[model samples]
Target: MMLETAFTPFYSLAGGALIGLAAVLLMLTTGRIMGATGILAGILQPTSLPDWSWRAVVLLGMISGPGAVLLITGQLPAVQVPVSTIMLVIGGFIVGVGVTFSSGCTSGHGVCGMARLSPRSIVATLTFMITTAITVYLIRHVIGV
Candidate 1:
């Protein structure tokens, strides 16, 4: 079994707090849930649409925040994934497609949806979890990828 690092608990708690804060702020201020996937998809919509710029900004911050922190602190965590660039791109594309078809990504369905007690979000979240579990099992055990 893989053991967590010494900083794991602190990092997990900090991450959870940040997520909770973002969710609360978004709901209170914009009356919308803070879901990165949904925010990113909104940016891809028409430029003439209202509220697209803020969504884009939010997505940008979401992408850049960790990088900025790592840059400032000079302590970026190591990534353990051994997949090739091609496989990474393919995996990302598949995830994008899956999120699109499922109507929301895990964060949207699992976090915000569960908070709101939406039945559809509950089902979608379960589907995401189950699919992820199966895929990981296949990659690590069956295919040994």
Candidate 2:
């Protein structure tokens, strides 16, 4: 939970401001929150064929923006995770399925929806958080994984 010195308080504030701005802008422009998983799921729907070019661009930026920043700065921090590649892929797939079933991702429900005080979003976000906490506890303690 601790940010490195390279990620100063100013950087953290700026990043948060950018996220807030992006979410606000997206809501104002498209009546949609900037949630990656929801957008990705929307792209996957076969019936949604009314110019998803913007969605594609947003997704591409989500994927490449960090890399672009690293390229510009010539310095990228290493990400350390204990899980294997297969576990990571499986986890991602499970998360995608969960988000689809829940009708929104954490960013959508937990951030934007909560800001608007949506009851369904509050329930969904709480459920997601509780489930995640229990799963982590079971994995780290019961299963020792």
Candidate 3:
């Protein structure tokens, strides 16, 4: 099958700008890193009610984008999963392990950390990019999946 890549340059740029703004706002308001995994983890076992509340709010806001789209456009945005459920589960497990080992997710390292010129975040972000490239090559070209 041909890989269908949607080149939505304007949408991508707007989405990226919004994400950057959210990261900046989170840092400015809470002095917290905008790592999705970290936020989820905090909600799972938050140290305090306020911590849990903010994490929950962040998670809700992340999910509510689709609802907002539905309200404005009369439908949710199209989402396509290019892999099987098993593959998705395995990929999620691998990502969980990577996050645990790396101590931060892409939003933390790639967006915030690199923006701050953090050495560890720089290395982590590079590793993430290289691994992502290799993974896509293997999946699409080598495995033809």
Clashing residue pairs in candidate 3 (N, C-alpha, C atoms within 3 angstroms): none
User: Which parts of model 3 are misplaced by more than 4 Å?
Assistant: none
**Root-mean-square deviation per candidate:** 2.7, 3.4, 1.4
Q: Write the residue-wise lDDT of candidate 2 on 52-138 in tens digits.
A: 766887788777867976997887645767767887899899997898888887778888888899999999999999999998788
Estimate TM-scores for all models.
Answer: 0.85, 0.81, 0.92
Task: Quote the positional error of residue 92 for candidate 3 in Å.
Answer: 0.6
C-alpha lDDT values of all predictions: 0.81, 0.79, 0.90
Winning model by lDDT? 3
Model 3 TM-score? 0.92
Instruction: Name the regions of candidate 2 deviating beyond 4 angstroms.
Output: 1-13, 46-50
Q: Give the clash count for model 2.
A: 0
Ranking by lDDT: 3, 1, 2
Q: Who is ahead in TM-score, 2 or 3?
A: 3
Candidate 1 colliding pairs: none
* lDDT digits (tens) for residues 1-145 of candidate 3: 3548879999899989999999999989999999887898888878999989999999999999999989998998988877889988999999988987887888988898999999999999999999999988898899997
Find the candidate with the highest TM-score and give its number.
3
